[model samples]
Target: MVRILTSFVWLLICFSCAPKEESIVQQMEAKGPIPHPTEAPDQWLLAHIDVETTGLLPGYHEMIDIGIVMTTLEGTFIDSLFLRIQPAHPERLSPGARAVNAFDAHKWAQLGALNRSAAVDSIISFHKRAAGDNHVLMVAYNSHFDSAFLDHLFRSANKTWREMYYYFILDIPSMAWGLGLKDLNSAWIMDRYQVKDEPHIADQHTGITGAMVNVRIYKALLQYRQDLLAAVPVP
Candidate 1:
């Protein structure tokens, strides 16, 4: 009788200590859907940004190149900025990253890549010119990845990400997922939306090329949503 009672108590303790599984509905409620813009589309601007890094981690890796394609919220072309930033910590450059980005030290040197300070200044100036007093919305294929590196870059230059951009980021994959896309991969989404093939070669992928691809994907997704809504007959 005592052994049974002890076993029951142990089981109860174990159950209490175990992490509870959160329901899908609870998770959805916690995260919520991406919020709609409170203001008119034309009133805002989108900074389609892409950055090529030395590695994956922000502080460990350095941004070697940054590309920003500014557009009106409705996807009207505004202006673009591309900066080849000289890596501050060359020692941190990883072989995998080098293979992916095809980082050529000699070529970057010949191009006169901007130093970290100069790169940050240029980015700030670009945003000021594009947005004036308003904060530009950041749009990226993988916003969390790019934003982490970008925020680190800004911090390294004694600046904050919020100085030039809004707090909320617009991620291409998230947008596609929200639009009911089953396959979130860029290739799949592009094919589904009939977006043109990426022009840059895999070995020589540039930041500008990535930014352009992301912009096109975003525009295509927007159009797809519009067409879907339009197809539904109204009363």
Candidate 2:
């Protein structure tokens, strides 16, 4: 009787320590429609963002600077935020990355660049002013690249990226393709739309400049699509 009771107690302990399975209902509920950040569900603002990173990979690389340009759905300028972040792990910076952004440690120190925490705080404040209570939809030329680095930055600062922006990202190249633009290359699309040319020199590649260019490209695409639809004539 004693051995049987002991076995029963051990079984009880094992059951208690076992990991709980997630309920399918709970998972489905969590994926239910997300409330629109703005009063009008269809009218959330766009956040055109660009980031200059220390490397290509997220966990291994770090964001050196970020540029965010907020605009209305119709592409009217709202506000902008640019932050130069002092590298937390400079040793991990790739030589090719340095060549691209001209990441001079001395110049960054002289400019008094914000550390990760301060940069994250500034980003949050900027979003608050631009988005108010709602989240902005992220737009970028190569969104995945920028979003991944930004995600790492936010995580490192112990902040949630979802609070500031939506999970769905709008890609400029994809938009161009959807609009029947044959060339998906940024420079080609920009030239097609008569937008200003991006800088040619490697070191001239900065976040704010790229962000501004991307925003222009997005606006151009929107205008092109509108013109095309207008030419179609109403049935």
Candidate 3:
């Protein structure tokens, strides 16, 4: 009888710890339809995310900043959040990397940047509120680079909650290629769109501004794609 009770308790613990299998479609169905049908159109969360790190090398350098902008599929701006973290290993931050990001370890130290754990928790909370039941579709300039660090951030934050975000990300450069836009840097893209912002300038290149620029680039590329598709003759 004692052995059976112990085994039952263990089973309960295991079951409670497992990840719940629920897709976005099921979640939307449970919540019913969205209020605005014509206003925002499609439902998924469009997140233009950017990360600034100590250096380009993954694992070797820590992420110092994170920025995300949540928008509707129709390109309506919803909300944005920016988070910064202080590295435990600041010695690894090379002068070139620091100069590129305009980050000084001593300055951030004096300013009292958020520790890794706190920054991670805050970012997670912000994402949950922004995403809600809608699927999170991330758009980044160079997804592979950012994803490497973000993957580390999630995995390092809490192993249990690593599944909190989307598995895949969309690259803005790839979108531009598909849309037949010029394969140029974000500054050039912004120039083509006449956005009137010098976001790529080294001093102005914080994660927040970077994310905003990324979103602008995404919207422009999407518009180009739509125009091309509409112009195509039906087979």
Candidate that would win on TM-score: 2
What lDDT tens digits, residue by residue, belong to model 2 across residues 86-127?
Answer: 888888889889878988766787877899889999998999
What's the distance in Å from true for residue 194, model 2?
1.2
Best by lDDT: 2
Q: Candidate 1: list runs displaced more than 4 Å.
A: 1-36, 199-203
Residues 1-235 of candidate 1 have per-residue lDDT tens digits of 9999999999998776443322322433453233345645545789999999999998889999998999887777889998999888877889988877877667788888888989999998888887875547899987889999997887676666676666689998888888888576767768777887555553468788888888898888888899889999999
lDDT of 3 by residue, 1-235 (tens): 9999999999998775443333323433454334443454464777888888888888888888888899987667999998777877778887877777877777777767788888878877887888786666677888888888876665454432233445557788877766556555755556666765535555567778878877777777666667778999999
Question: Each prediction's Cα lDDT score?
Answer: 0.80, 0.81, 0.72
Per-residue lDDT for 191 in model 1?
78
Clashing pairs in 2: none
Sort order, lDDT high to low? 2, 1, 3
RMSD to native for every prediction? 11.7, 7.4, 7.3
RMSD of candidate 3 to true structure, Å: 7.3
In candidate 2, which residue ranges exceed 4 Å CA deviation?
A: 1-43
In lDDT terms, how accurate is model 2? 0.81
The better-scoring model by lDDT among 1 and 2 is 2
> Could you give me the TM-score of model 1 versus the true structure?
0.80
